[model samples]
Target: MEQLAEKSKKREFVKHPGLGETGIFHTKADGDPLPDSQLLTFALAGNQNCGKTTLFNQLTGSNQRVGNFPGVTVDRKDGVIKGHANTLVTDLPGIYSMSPYSNEELVTRQFLLQDKPKGIINIVDATNIERNLYLTIQLMELNIPMVLALNMMDEVRENGGSIHINEMENRLGIPVVPIAASKNEGIQELVDHAIHVAKNQERPGRMDFCDPDHDNGAVHRCLHAIIHLIEDHAKRAQIPLRFAASKVAEGDEEILKALNLNQNELELLGHIIQQMEDERGLDHGAAIADMRFKFIKEICDATVVKPKESKEYARSVAIDNVLTGKYTAIPAFVGIMSLVFWLTFGVIGTWLADGLDLGITWLSELVDLGLTAYGINPVVHSLIIDGIFAGVGSVLSFLPIIVTLFFFLSILEDSGYMARVAFVMDKLLRKIGLSGRSIVPMLIGFGCSVPGVMASRTLPSERDRKMTILLTPFMSCSAKLPIYALFTAAFFPRYGALVMIGLYFTGIVTGVVFALLLKGTMFKGEPVPFVMELPNYRMPGFKNVWQLLWDKAKDFITRAFTVIFVATIIIWFLQYFDPRLNAVSDSQDSLLALVSGIIAPIFVPLGFGDWRISTALITGFMAKESVVSTLTVLLGGSTASLSTMFTPFSAIVFLVFTLLYTPCVAAIASVRRELGGKWAVGVAVMQCVIAWVVALFVNLLGIMMGWV
Candidate 1:
């Protein structure tokens, strides 16, 4: 009877899977002690042009951000592996070492020690093994379990070098995985092995400190002394003894600060380091680094195997030579960018917009037919067809253009050429106190300023990030393209395409000039160094490209429906309510006209101070697209019929104002969120003042020359 009762009770206690144990597999029955498995946080670290991010993205999928260059990843990035649920990979700022060489290095070291990730996924460029392994050795000393992912394996094999993973594993006492990150080759296995090592399924061994008897004896001795010192310090600090010790031996400043070393110990350590440097004719810190590389070379020699030939490897080498060529790079970059914009605006964009316009017209007719069939009154019919369909639907009719433009940009970014563009543009950008990475947000700004402003969150420094966000609105958004197209076609039909291109470039120049002026006066700061990971060229996945297009297109359409939808209604009311009854005669009696008239005197020097132009500027704060809508309402028709849009002076003045005015409300809110209350207020006022001044200057010059 007792056994029967026990069996019955046990039958009710069958274990569940997900809540059962801590590891990848279940280890015990219900109500057992929690397992020892943990979420292994691994940071992918490497150098510029080393494919570090490609490897990171390959491991993490699309679960990462393309942040600013040189310390943009000011915080840790965590992404869960699809296959290994317990593993969380972190993509750290690419750095040459864990030492506090720059802001980027500081971020990387701080996360490794302070944040205490489970393991370090040190990505090394196989083609540049000699240089890359320098960072690998520094990581090894941190005493954290690490896996060296030899990324760009194809490049290495093509460059006539081989990495023996088994030999390296045995020598370093850690797992070493070879992968071509861009090709998505060997990524799954790499993540699996990383998880295994992180969860203690496989454990890393110690790095070989180098043989002591050769001419490099002093190098070995310095490393030995540093290791012992670190171990002793770790014991008192009560941290992870191995990582803590390695950091101390490596002379990590953050670690020293964390330890709160006494003056005497600090003085003694300094004296020891000085003495070592004097006696060995080498810095103790540098000597230890050399020993690690020497050890890495020895291990690499024994383990790696290579085939007789690698065609992919050869192609990568050939392309790098041409792409990075001193004379060829810039022209190539400019030509490509120009082509993309030309095709975007002149060919693909127009075709898509026309097609969608036809569709929207057809839809409007269908709605009209339904209303007539119901015998709706004329006022009701006009409200349904003219107000809703003609007004709102007209704005929404250009969805195809937005979709096509986004698709082109998405492909460029995913193909890894976007980084190349940044690299080539770095020389020019640095002159203006901006890094090459600023181009990413600028490109995004062309789509919409809201996202462009948000993209600045990736910038490493608060000042630079704010500056980039503030100026991004100057980029000519896709909505502005139609305005440019209309004016150019009406005024300079033969040169419409060229004039449109010129307007876009004008925005670029203004942004650059403004950034320089701000840096020189209001936002002075040290020039942040430029270091970027140039991923190997790879064929972008069709699925990835399509998904990006869909997301961006959907966002554009959603905005048109919500923010633009509400703004249109508000604008209609402003046009409808005319206390003076003057709008019906001169189209300026409406409330919008009253507001514009009040601001007209301020724009008198620009010569074109009509209430219509003034009201467009006023409504622009809601959204740039609203500028077109307000102008259409004021003129009582489409801008496609306007003749003034094409004069050189008027075009110049218009572009200047468009580039400098206050950004949309959403962007202003983001700025407030990033910069806090007072600074946001400051940005709004400063931008408006700047816009008025520049636009006035151009307008006055045009009138004096009798060109307007």
Candidate 2:
């Protein structure tokens, strides 16, 4: 062990990728040193739902949404450590391994290899140590400074399991700190160890997990021969020999391309791997994985005391019997969502929103009286009372409803039920050329389509990502809640919750139908296999639920003030003024109505032919909330006025249009970023066309059934 430590000490790889071997890192990619080099960055990594994000929140005190399901952190997020501005921690997307099979794993691998962080803070689920350590084994090959955070230690101890931290640390040639991330236990020590190793450039002492005496030395001999053969190529590619060699042995095409190996060298390497696989009685990838697991088993045998299954698992199994049962899962999902909508629209949220609306209306009337008494300019009074208050305040009242819905969703997420939803959805998603993994993004879409679009990046298949992005806009985002709230209150007050649930279900069904069509035409292939961990269910933590609620509230409030605010102001100005800049008492003769009149004819067949309604729907592209605020201002801030704009049948058609129409600009931008401009344009055009056709179909059907 001492001799291996000496060897590791002698080898000094670059702290930052594509930089000098010196421990000092520079600020710029050009490798020029700067004072900013003092900033030390570490990577927070772990398998999904292993409490990696809980530790990130503890370390940085930043609330980056932490859900028990995978793909929550689909992209990298960096934060400064609490009380340590000089140290930064980047929470990487959850990944199972370094293999570039999935997009998240590939992104993590590229980041580690190309934009190397100084150290890795590898958090592992101590209760499920064997599976978590598989990733840890791969990370050790990077040869960077790392500290193993044995997370969920409290759970392990409660379940009668224990780990010999010092022994495991010594065996793995890295520091191991026991921690309960959720409880913020042992985090300081983990931070101190990470900072110390990074500053001191402490690489892993052991690079050789395979013992030469094992398997009659077949695996050992093959690894050493390939390492020697590719030593120069690995160095030329600026990759650690250990990692490059392992990837080469596993036939990773990306690593092979990076190594730029010549034909002869490749052939020789293949022959050595083939010989090893023959002797080991396995394929190359299996042989390598078997060897690594064998090493992990030995280490666990020596240092880990396996625990009895905990009550959490027992409860999860009991819950799964109903939640994920073949015949019951879908019905349970529908019932749960129905209940959430009922509470949000029919009872709690609606009551709170009504109270808020009354308060706002009182305030608005008071302002109106003050302006009239003071003889304020009519235009200025309208901007403040009708524009800002009527517009922004109208959407603001829905905040409680949005937050309440997210609250229930977050509980489902933190309790680990979301993972079961994905598992149960795999079969259905596959039929539409998607996997259960696509459900994460789709679920996120219900909150907002931007992150939902971004979450598609976690999908490995391009076909699935594109289809998921296309379908997300149909998943009735919370932004459209105001539209539903407005119409339901004006048209279907007693059936608000039922109507809301029906709208959401309709959006989902419409998306599924389109997805099936796209599968057969645009993306003709099956979805990739869906493999994910089902975390043991536990009570939702207050912190996680609060953080999610706060995030939703903050995002909604910001957009209401920013995008929706500007949009409402512009809409009010256009509605009240003619093209010659003259204020008009009648909005129908105003500039906004005249312009929207051009599009009004197109929707005449769908039943909403009014220019004011057309203008509101058009403004919704800027912000979906704008549809509510614009309509409120244009209709003179009275919900009762909405009744005269459309009959009940026409209102349902309008709701259907809004539910299936293109998402706001932010979501489209996300799609453009992911799939490029053409796909973004296609998605927008496709959604609008589908929405019109569906609305028209509903209108025609209602007439046929004598329900119009």
Candidate 3:
């Protein structure tokens, strides 16, 4: 261990001629330093919901960052493996193939081809090994060193199935590790094997899943001819010969372009592909899929033992009978979400938040007394007590609600109920010009809109991607939880959970209404059909649930200290000064009030016309959480004073506006990157217009019903 540490230290220090003793070397274009030789990188690839992310989180723990692949909005998660010094693991976006049919597949393929990671960790779902191995064959053709992690082996074993791991490893010519990632079982073994494979420069010995020269059909003949034709070119391009050959046979335009094939070569390739299609009675793509699956079946037949009846599978079926039923699915989904909300807002979360608020109040008073005794300047006291503490502390007090909500959401995701929700919503989502796949991003939006908007990249169609991005903000992310908690606590404490559910329902309804309007006019197109695998349900691990809760708490606290802290200072400065930079005795005479007053009258019809309310809304564009913090600062952190600003009807209207209005600047930036600048601007304008009109109608309705 000491020798390895010494070697790592030596590798970390690289001598540059112009910069002596420098520990890092920067690339000229991006100035990002490359990892040293001692730092090995392994790509983790697998199908969606195949325990891949669970394995990744176990391997990397908290040492991960969410980034983007070059020129793509898809998430690129990279992390340093636990207990494996100088080894980095990248969790590729979940994909079922390497065919570039979708952005995720393309990104994963391009990263492997371009970045050339040292090894690949192909995690397969053990319970459904046959289907998952289709991707395994494709990854093997990459010719990189790889380890097959047969994940969820515990579940498979529990259900009376068994895999001969050693036999499977021998057949596949790669290391196979049986693991239950959720249980943190066999993770260390998996990581150790992965490191050994990477360091030894081990490559898969059995790359040909289907014999190219065999006289299976014309498809075999065509693949053989293409491999021979492209062997030299593939070698020169540093691509795996068999992989390039298969892609060429399948008529992948990207691979053809990358190969820089001549015109005559292209024509020859096309003739071969067409000949195979004509003779075999199958298209090139279909023929390739058929051959791959046939190979997978042979391997599975030899090494896997399946029970006629699987208890887990039977249970899942029983649950899905009702959960995915035509009549019960939607209602079940609503009931499930309502239960989540009740737990978060009405019971556990509300109690925790109340305790936190009281603690913060006590701390603030103690600090105030100390400041007063110390004879601190009044201006400084006001800035610390009212500006920073009032603003940031108000947001922080709702951390329990955010954490609790995400905890339950994580449980739903881990237990596989969320996947069923997507399946159930497919029919309804299709009517809005989106596939059920868009629900994944929408559900993520309920946690945070930035990632929600980015998640839209998973949609295969460009129109669906843009439409999903535009509508995701209407899902009401956790950042707005503080706003809801504050208002409900002050005005509607008795119905906190119901009001919270209503806000979410309002957001969904608003999004659906706009989706219909947009589909009928601007972005008219039929959504592509959704296809996804639903993993068998399992009990969510307590450790995994606790980690997710910690992550939410950490993120919320980090934002409070950073974005919210800086924003609070800026807002305080604006409210504390006049145009001439003179101190203002009255905030209404200050710069913030002056600026907000310009837009205050516009919200009069929606019921929130106060300059302070307008100011809070404006700050909300910076971050939705800022709405609560800004209001807290303006109202002097008194719930009683804040409560007087609105009656129940106006509060409902305000909540409706908040729910449907434009997302934060960060989300808009994500939209701009995913869609375009014009679309981003259009979404902001359209959401504001929609929000205003909807709020006005809600207020008028309330008046007519005599609720005000």
Candidate 4:
């Protein structure tokens, strides 16, 4: 270890891909010239599936949350390095090119242009350099000081391809590093180089833009001329005016409108393009892209080498077949989901919660004993032990259940099966006017609506983002999980798993159907094209999995103690201070009871009109998990013995209401913020009405048929 440290100290290595040296980084011995207090931001940019996200996690660690850009649904992630202080990393949405054809690309471009981070860490999958380099070339054009981290080198070596790092570096005038992010190789060096570059220890040169010879081509002249014209007209735009001019010369419709060029100017530009095409005998866009590829190919050819056979390559191919192939993949996908849910809510979750509930019960008893021994006021003691502790802590004690669920989800994500699920389900989702990728945000919604709605930021289109946010609340969140678990355990002991699965699917199917109807009218738009990168899978790392589990558990615990704690206090006030309840009224004569009773009639068609359930649904707006807490408070005891608490009809009605209800206030605020006031109001109203009708219909049908 000492020798390795010493070796790292002496060598001043830049990232070199060909020699299997991406960078020479200092793993230890910090507090040098670079101030420990300064935050270093690394922006990871690459084409879709270039292993950029994988590498980002490997470098900074996976203590992150999925979020959306303000006013947009694009996923925005920011994380601090666990081992390295003063280093912050952001995983930008993947983009095919920095051409801004989609929201992800635009978000990435906007961040790069405006945020101006310390340095850009551009990851390129070594195996597919040709396709990946298109984005790399665009990044070079951005003029951001960058370090090229070439990832997935193992795949390249197996595919009869070799790249010379030194030669490519000499050619592109930027440092290049080769790494296998999945295997956790060369990560230290990557970070060290990042620190060095960020600190100005070494500087990257300006990219040399090549003026390829297109001898006397009229299209080339006209394109250049039109570019100059735009530059002359919009001097104040300060917008990659050159790139804008190039797109206009190629007749990009979006760009044309964005720049607001009228028909006469557009016609003149088109005529110029035609003239250039006649002379060059090539399409302008095609010609430009082809030239970029040629440059990348030449660089790769000079430096890297391929091997005939490699175990990693063979394994990647075999796994891809089983995980993504049509016939077996679909069943595998369903089985995986079933197993995860079953484990989370049935076996692992229930057992953990039961154990914790026992502890809470014991703790409450201990508190009560102390209160009784001291001759404390009975009312004060009851409020402290039962209402506060039992009410709040009991609901909060489910942290183990929530954490275990997120652990499994994080493992699946790390293994890359999540992408395959989307790939497999795309066709089915399209039938319902949704995309398979929509599952991610909805699945997240199950945990918490805030992050779930925030996860919609990864969607590439505005319409899709809006639809996802609007419908995600339909999924029974973790808070609703307890309600279902309580009722299922109570009424359908033998078929608890099956009943829970039905509720989940009800939420899913309703969301899909709602999406179809929604798109057919308001927020009408065609299903955007689906393109996602499925990264190479790896054995799940125990450390990464543990970190993810703890992170998720920590979030639940924090909210329970803070948000839910405060919410419980407010609820206590509402129930206790009701005019009727304060006036020595019977339990049924409370002001809240009367208020709920007024709304109860509206739900009578659904068969469960006790007003208690109505109150639970209304409280769900604060946070879904609060639903279970509210129910526990109203029921006045442990949910462990729910068999006597609710009838089968009431359980079914409860599950339906839980599944279809509107999202929490936080989620609604996010939607209103992202989609604006008009659409936000529409979404909230639509969700409430749909949830009421669906719950009512389910309840009525069960009563009419005597099934409940």
- lDDT of candidate 1 over 634-702, digit per residue (tens): 444344535543355665677677767787777778778877878778778977887888788777777
Models, CA RMSD each: 8.5, 4.8, 8.6, 7.2
Candidate 4, residues 289-384: lDDT per residue as tens digits?
Answer: 655676677776676575565565567679878877878888787788788778877788878877888898888889889999999986577567
Residue 62 alpha-carbon offset, candidate 1, angstroms: 3.0
Off by over 4 Å in 3: 1-39, 63-73, 211-219, 260-281, 576-586
lDDT of 2 by residue, 428-498 (tens): 99888899999999999988899999999898888888888888888989899989998998889899999
lDDT of 3 at 40: 87
Candidate lDDT scores, in order, read: 0.65, 0.87, 0.81, 0.68
TM-score of each: 0.80, 0.94, 0.89, 0.84
Q: How close to the true structure is residue 540 of candidate 1, measured as C-alpha lDDT?
A: 67
Clashing residue pairs for model 2: none
Which run of 10 residues does model 1 get worst, by summed lDDT? 19-28
Instruction: Name the weakest run of 10 consecutive residues (lDDT summed) in model 4.
Output: 65-74
Clashes of each: 5, 0, 0, 18
